[model samples]
Target: MTAKRRRFVRDNGLTLAFGMAFLLALTGQAFAGHAEFNNELAADGLAPIGLAAYLASSEFAVDVTENWQSEYLQFFLFILGTVWLLQRGSPESKEIDEAGPESDKEQRVGQYARADSPHWARTRDWRQTVYSRSLGLLMGGLFLLSWFAQAVAGSAAYNEQRLRQLQRPMGWGEYVLGADFWSRSLQNWQSELLAVASMAIFSVYLRQRGSPESKPVGTPHGATGVES
Candidate 1:
């Protein structure tokens, strides 16, 4: 096979492998969720849902979406926040001198763009303007979408619980204002923030021999990305 074909196969194979792993983990979560859901139903003298029904249920959707939203939010906040926030000697951060958005030349936009650069990168239009900040924008968009998904799904799940308890089912607006929504959102968000904060601070004093997340074992704590 040609080098191009080999490279394509390697890249595609890795992507497919990761995709399969993701689906496998999701499927495992679904099955475990279904079992746990049915256990709760049994405890409450309610009928248990089948796997397919459980998969389609708001419970599953809300649980998945809550985690998804938190992850996206973490990335979105970290990506945007790291611009202004400095973490000394952490690989996840920009250096002290590199605060704020860099110049277009540094970002390879307009005249500094390569021949094969994206059309938007070369264009003198709104598309180019948006594309320039597209990474953070897309991350923020995904964070919003996932958060919205969590809200919608959480409302359904909350209503289900309410109905199970012979209580009134809430409207979307009411559900949004309810404590359940904020509790779910805040719990995941707090954990994500803690994790991100820990990583930033811990990497300053820690070293993992082969991990990209850490500086080299022998490297000084002040060193940034000196991976072994």
Candidate 2:
């Protein structure tokens, strides 16, 4: 009922809505994935798996993990790259003069930190040191974790296929070095890079109306977030 409570609800409502939407979409994908996987099993003369079993299978794990790795890699690269790079008119990038990590004052750390700033910002110690690089660090770590998950799951999926054909199942090392693994990784990686590049370049000339991703419609093409 109070202003603070109303502000909190409004600020967090979008995040909650999107989180539920993402979960629903993922659940739908899992069901569709299970059905398709079972169809493949039938074609190969293998017993069809139930939804629970299919979800537990390496096929689902590998598919999910491969996509996750690509997403994390994209974020990791974007966060790190934007520090040194400038897109003249894009909302996603800082202006040319504001390049690099910028001063501690600009980042609102230590003496410049506000009363409600994060504890790490006030600590002035190792916590602040790590928190300063936390965004890129977390993204990089998640990328590695997702990549490893993909490798492990892919190996299991690959072995299952080999066994179905009465061929010898491969060891993890062999599977990691195989064409299938690299192909899956490269395909996703290329698409992610393409999307990021397109967003960076397109935002220079495009206007998305009220969307934060674009400058205001009336703004000059050379103008940046200042126009928004």
Candidate 2: stretches off by over 4 Å:
1-9, 225-227
In the range 45-102, model 1's lDDT, one tens digit per residue, is 9888899999999999999999999999999999889888888788777777888888
lDDT of each: 0.89, 0.91
Model 2 agreement with the true structure over 63-169: per-residue lDDT tens digits: 99999999999999999999989888888888878889989899999888899999899778899899999999999999999999999999999899888889999
Q: In model 1, which regions exceed 4 Å deviation?
A: 1-6, 12-17, 224-228
For every candidate, C-alpha RMSD to the true structure in Å: 2.4, 2.2
Worst 10 residues of 1 by lDDT: 219-228
lDDT of 1 at 7: 88
Count of clashing residue pairs in every prediction: 0, 0
N/CA/C clash count, model 2: 0
Q: What TM-score does candidate 2 reach?
A: 0.92
